[model samples]
Target: MIAIVSAPTNLGLRPPQPGAVPGTAKAPEALREAGLHARLLGEGATDAGAILPGRYVDHPNRSRNAVRNHEAIVDHARRLAARLVTLTREGRAPLVLGGDCSLLIAAGLASRVARPSGLVHVDGHTDFRHPSNSPEIGALAGEDLAAAVGLHLPEIADIDGLGPYFDRAATAHIGCRRDDEHLDELADTIGLVLPADRVVMHGAARAAADVLELPALDRGFWLQIDVDVMDPQYMPAVDSPDVGGLSPDELIRLLGLLAPRAWGASVTVFDPDLDPTGRHARTIAEIVATGLRDLGRDLAL
Candidate 1:
């Protein structure tokens, strides 16, 4: 059985400009409207309900919103982790739908509770910024990987006093743009990274195979996809859209190869507000359904 959980928190995004509407917070519902739940067989579904974020605020010394919303993010992470722990303990795979990439903190924390876990991070950007090196630190979503590995951001890194959610050697990052900020540094920490160019050159199936061969395969892993990992031409509904990315078909192929090995998975950073035509939402639903079907089949075995 697969449990679909909704985590709608946008405190991680750079605070919306004066009149800008927040679209990611609406992603879970938009995906449902596009038939994700029904296609996945709603019988096993569990709505973990949304965790709304507090208003974004700035600080003089720390990252804007990062310091102000620190407590709130931690609270939400704890609650979300608890729900994931329950589902995993019962042998149900979790399909977490997100409001932004920050949910990784929660998911990574939850994975550690079950056992030592690895992460397969599929995204357009590295999302591994450290406050000491970051010129501006307003968004937690951008620093998720750093926190996950206990690299920086103490408040987020030290969730429940359990830091370094995933062992550095056990994690693998795929589909990130080659020119991402600090790409070299993040590679050093993540250990296994298949950049966009590599995925395109080697093909998604081969890239997925290499990721699976990385350390910690036996310890279980979380498969995370930020929709922006798909090319902007195919998925233009993200806050930060890099030029080069995987095609939808390529992403689907990679997901099919990785799903059977993942204990849980998450789809994040898809902003429905940008996709006025709803095309992106429907595409996301198809990708998730296809991946979860494979995951369910693997679990059945």
Candidate 2:
């Protein structure tokens, strides 16, 4: 069985401008409208619904919205974790839809609660920024991986009183673009990183196969796909767009390889507002559906 959970909160994105269109918050419905739920055809679906985020507020000394919604993000992560545990206990694979990449904190917490787990982080950005690196902590989305590993920010790092959500050795980061100044330092600290350049060199299939070899996969792993990992030309409706990403077909093929092994998965950061024509939404639905269908065949769900 597969359960679809909607986590629509832009607290992580924290658009610089207030009142910006809330497209990411609408991603769950958008993808469902494009037939994601129908394609999965499982035990059933659950609309976890959107978790409304606080208004974005800027702080000269802190990351834009990080402090403003700090408690809310934690509280919501706990709630989401409980939901994930329930679903898993019920024998369903949870397909989490997102508002931004920050939901990783919740996903990690859920993994700890449900079972030992590993993570396959597929994103354009490594999202491993430590709060100490910059006084301004703008958004949790950019620092999720750092927090997950207990690098900084106890609020997120210690979710459910468990720090270092996934063991560093058990995590594999793939498809990150080499843009951040601290990329080298961050990469050194992570378990396995298949950067965009490497993915380009070896292809998504080879890259994914390498990630699967991590010891964390022994107990299954969570698959985290941030749409920005796709080439902007192919998937432009994301919080951050980067050049030289995988094509939609390549992404699907990679997901097909990874999904069967995923204990659960989440699709994050696709903004439907940016995709006014709905072309991007439909494409995302297709990509996710194809992956889930392949996963179903593997699991015989």
Candidate 3:
């Protein structure tokens, strides 16, 4: 039962630069347009019944809305974290769909409840940079992974259910590339990293175990995918795009690789806004759908 959560909010971060291709604000519609409901799982008669209603996480990012009102992003993250827990409990695998890398804050916080679960984060950016590293420049997108893992951000670090957020050492990562100061420390803290090139070669399931070093808790893992993980050429609609990233087939391979089990697994694919031309969008949707289909087949459905 994969329950999809649509979190579409640009949070209105300032442009990276003029003429930069903008990330889309349209995901739910695009998902619909992809014929997802017509096939795979979740919502309106799909094989995996809709366990929870589609809720919008269209919250304001205070930093973008107004620096002083940063409380808004904190508040939203709080509420969204709690809601993610609710969705998870409803028996539908929490599939967090989002507009930015910020989605990880909520998902990572929610994962605390599923303690001892390995975090499998797939993305192009480390997302683990601190505020000091940020120097108040650029958007908050890159700083989230750091905040989620007990960094300088107090808003997320303070969540009651996710104290210490997660086992930094136990956190495993896949598809990492385009490192920044933020990601460098993030990789150090988490201590589990897989470059994009190696990830595809290893294959999703096996690579997931190797990168994460999964053992007894293989069943208990959080599955995360950042839309930017894909090559920008294949997926041109995003807040940030690095020169080298994973391909669509690679993502699909991972999705199919990671989809089958649950010892408490939460799948979050972010930055769908970066999915321009809808080629990547549809490809992502299809990968998600096919992954679910493969999961069903594996489960003997």
Candidate 4:
């Protein structure tokens, strides 16, 4: 069975304004309100409720030495991982509804509980920022990939002594744009680094086929989908929407090909506040439901 777990946390992002909070924390419920829950439920999926996060606080004057809401993020990740472990033990493939890319920490932690796991990260930007690559470092949502691969501070990176959640050789990053600053480093670290142009040239199906060849897939892999992977024209309702990205159709095809094979998956970074008309939520709901409709086929639920 495909179980839906909500991780509504914006603890990883910088505040858009001095006093206001990032609207991404409401993503899970926004998606559900768009009928995602109903569509999945009608298809026999189970609701695993939510793993609520601590309050979002942006201390602009705080030191850049650590991530914002550091304690909250770690606490939330542990709880989320525990929930995922239970669901996976029940033979359920979790479809995590995320608040931002920072949720990848939980996914990475959970994946290692059973056995070594791989990661397929699909996002517009590399999200690979780290102290070595940049001087300024605070928001985790912008540097989740780095944190997951153990390239960040040891605090969140080595939660419960389980650091480097996904082995560098077992990770694949797709959909990053050509101009992404960390592409060179990512190419050297990740098992496979396919930018948007390469994915377009090879085609979505071919891209997925290439990922399936990874040795990590032999054990299983987790899929991380950041909706900003779609073109800004198609999906501008995110924390950071770049100009050059894949089309909705391309993303749907890519996900449809990869979703079924993944042990579980996370969809993140869709800000409903920017989508007042609810059009974007509806689009995301469709993309996620249609793409992940066959999740956990091996269990035959």
Q: What is the TM-score of each candidate against the true structure?
A: 0.93, 0.90, 0.77, 0.97
lDDT of each: 0.81, 0.77, 0.56, 0.90
Task: Give the poorly placed runs of model 2, Cα more than 4 Å off.
Answer: 19-22, 42-68, 294-301
- Alpha carbon deviation, residue 109, candidate 2 (Å): 1.0
Distance (Å) between predicted and true CA of 180, model 4?
Answer: 0.3
lDDT of 2 at 295: 46
The C-alpha RMSD in Å for every predicted model, in order, reads 2.3, 2.7, 5.1, 1.3
**Clash total of candidate 2:** 5
Lowest-scoring 10 consecutive residues by lDDT in candidate 4? 292-301
Give per-residue CA lDDT, model 1, range 1-301, as digits (tens).
7788888777677655644545788899899999998887655566555556665544446634354367777888888888888888887888889888888988888878875678889999888887777766657788888888887667788887888888888888998887887788988777698898899888988998898887666566888899999889999899988888989888988999998888888899989888888888999999988855656345421
Put the candidates in TM-score order, highest first.
4, 1, 2, 3
- Which residue ranges in model 1 land beyond 4 Å of their true spot? 19-21, 42-49, 52-68, 296-301
lDDT tens readout by residue for model 2, 1-301: 5678888767676663664634677888888887776666543545444555555444445544254467767877887788887877776777888878788888889888776688888888888777777666647788887887788677778865888888888888888887756577667787788877788778878987898777767677888889998889999888778898988888888898888878678899989888888899899988988865544234322
Selected candidate, larger lDDT, 3 vs 4: 4
TM-score of 3: 0.77
Q: Of the candidates numbered 1 and 4, which has the greater lDDT value?
A: 4
User: Lowest summed lDDT over 10 consecutive residues: which window, candidate 3?
Assistant: 45-54
